[model samples]
Target: MRTVGNDLVRHQLHENRKWYLLLGALLIIFGVVLLASLGMATLSVVFLFGILMMVGGVLHIVAAFKIFDGGYRWLWAIFGVLYLIAGYYAFTAPVQTAVVLTSLLAIALIIGGIIRIINAFMFKPLPGWGWTLFSGLLTLLTGILIIASPTSPFWVLGMFLGIDILFQGINYLTLAAAIRNIPPSSADV
Candidate 1:
């Protein structure tokens, strides 16, 4: 059994986790809102989000540099480089990102629907399968529509932003909530 001191340390560790989770939650919210607003407007939201990502990516690179003395410095540098590349892409092609986001959403929905249908079939339930099946079918139909007209710039951008923003908001909220629930660390003492 751990001593009381260890318990306190554990609790402190939990608190740190809570803080990181809160940060992640914020990121998710930002992504969703940025995407949604992009849908509502046009290039403004996309630019804003891209700029944000770029700034964050640059900061990450600098941090990685600081850890050069560590064993995994190369790995960190690689990650930093990858983020930089992504940031550059986001900055250069916000519009394309908007369209891509829409495509991704449709594909995700279709996959999710298929998975749900499969799950429903897996469980031998004689009742309450109607709703599941209906939802799955609807998702599949939406997916088909997305695939049928990937070139519709307006629809794709609008939906992409809106859906991205909403989902990101929800993601942030969830992460924040999870962080808030972690037990306090003993280190507080």
Candidate 2:
């Protein structure tokens, strides 16, 4: 029986190779720029996140009012208010926000990497599964290093983000190559 990874790779190779290539190229370009301007890029990311949070809070508050007859509306309203406070803080204290956000990113990376590794193992015997495992391990290690050093440079956040994206681009390129190299029929276990 072919694993889900085999079917996914086959489908992507046959149907979305161009999209994969485009995404990989775009990520690589963006990653390079972020790495080049680590401090500025980190500030930009924090600012953007703040703006998004403010917008989301406003939207949620508006939506809560729109839902006239539901108890859930109150829950939404509370969340909206909390979001507003958080968003305001983010804007007012961007450097602190960046640090907190970076910590959250590290936690997310750690969790996501663990999940990916487990998923990769589940797709065993499939072609390129090792690549997925390797990517997951890298991600896990990066996250651990970030968490271990809270007093690192401010630019660490941006550098980490850039490195993560670069790896993602490489992973995409690697998957594309693997899919292109192996025929669908040959992927079956």
* RMSD to true structure for each model, in Å: 8.7, 8.7
Model 2: CA > 4 A from native: 1-34, 151-153, 160-189
lDDT of 1 at 85: 72
On the 0 to 100 scale, the lDDT of residue 164 in model 1 is 69
Per candidate, the number of residue pairs that clash is: 9, 0
Candidate 1 lDDT: 0.66
For model 2, what is the C-alpha lDDT against the true structure? 0.81
TM-score of each candidate structure, all chains considered together: 0.53, 0.63
Model 2 deviation from native, Cα RMSD in Å:
8.7
**Which stretches of model 1 miss by more than 4 angstroms?**
1-45, 66-71, 124-126, 160-189
lDDT by residue (39-117, candidate 2, tens digit) is 8778877777788888888988988899644898988888888888888888899889988987887898899899989
Output the number of the lDDT-best candidate. 2
lDDT of model 2 at residue 88? 87
